[model samples]
Target: MLIVTPVTPVTPTKTNFEFEIMNQNIVKALAGIMEKPGTTKRDTLAISRRVTRYICQQRRHLLTERHALRRKARKLRQYLPFTALAVADLEQQASDHNAELLEAYRRVLAAYGRSIIHDEEGIAAALGFDQLAALLNINPVHHEQAKREGGETLQGLVFVARMEDSASGFADEWGAGGPLFEACMAGLADFIRTCPDHLLPDPFAPGEVFGPKLPPQLRMV
Candidate 1:
């Protein structure tokens, strides 16, 4: 027989890490929910109707929260246009299936969860490698129109989230961010803290970072 001591699991220091993972799960679950209805399977129209009301209600609540945050000088959510963007994507999806209403609501939810993702290759070229790699890891790159050129141009909008860095005395300002958005700052900090060397953006090795800055022949967007 052997005596054993209990070992404690390390708590995730960064909150957004958990937040993003949860949100991804939510997205997957929503897809499943929409595809199959309860009791009597929701016909496409019925599902569309249900989702529409759900989004409208969520939008109102979000608007209220935005107002309160603005009033209190807290960081206002900059995702108002997000829903609009999703609307555009969902419209395409709807057009594919001819589900007008369903597309609209899908757009709303999609925008509800839009963010950017960029590696440090460019930012390192401008700022430095260390800072770029420090950004939080969130969403993937958005492929609207595959660019034939200018690889450095960011195809993602990384969420420039609020940082809890005591040393970073910056205010929580919300709005558009540069193309160099790599990840949520909170996650970035965690990445740097835990895995400083095992990440991307090894700019000193350019070929490894962004593939030798694409040839001039490719027309970039």
Candidate 2:
């Protein structure tokens, strides 16, 4: 007679790593639930909460990175207006300044990378969907035209969705109400926690809002 030993699974130490795997699991579970809608609210919420916690952890990681990138992107945005103005007011040196501005824009894109694969709006643009990008209010055709014309009229150059959108997106999904909503909303709250005081939007004056309204929370920046 022979005996067999069970293998022990290894768990990731870093929360991000754990969440990354958990995200896949949650997506699969959601798909399974979609196939058979008889899942109890308690079970659904339990799964949603787990997914939400994972999302919160991922958002925290992005938030930390966002602080640095936001400043860099903002600076790029500021330069675009200035460069455009220089082109308009001081035509001769416009070519040189435009080159510099283009370089700065490249840097911002390189820094942002394709990490936002989960977000459809971002992924589409990141994958070079110029028309879709225009529709998404990210790198709109008018902005491109303005860039080509060297004009400073386009005010909303830098677009980043507010933290609230991410949670709301998941909550707003059909057949994902109740506990799922609470879970997603909770995830957004966690994202807010990672934000610095400066990043936090003021109640009196909100930040730039772009992307799908129906999805609720799905930002592309």
Best by lDDT: 2
Q: Please write out the lDDT profile of model 1 over residues 1-221, one tens digit for every residue.
A: 32222322223347856874675466456556655635222232233233433555444444454444333222212243434444344333323332343345445434322222242323324533223223322122311111222222222213322121212322234532321221233234444556757664553353332345433475778
What would you estimate as the lDDT of candidate 2?
0.37
**Model 1 worst lDDT window (10 residues):** 137-146
Clashes of 2: 3
Candidate 1 regions exceeding 4 Å error are 1-30, 33-42, 73-106, 109-221
lDDT against the true structure, each candidate: 0.34, 0.37
Per-residue alpha-carbon lDDT of candidate 2 for residues 1-221, written as tens digits (9 for 90 to 100): 22222322222369857766676677567647734657653343234334444444444444444344344434444456544433233333332333453443333222222212123233233333343233223334244542333212111111122111232342235423222223333433444566797887543343222322233576899
Clashing pairs in 2: 165-217, 166-217, 169-217
- Clashing pairs counted in every model: 7, 3
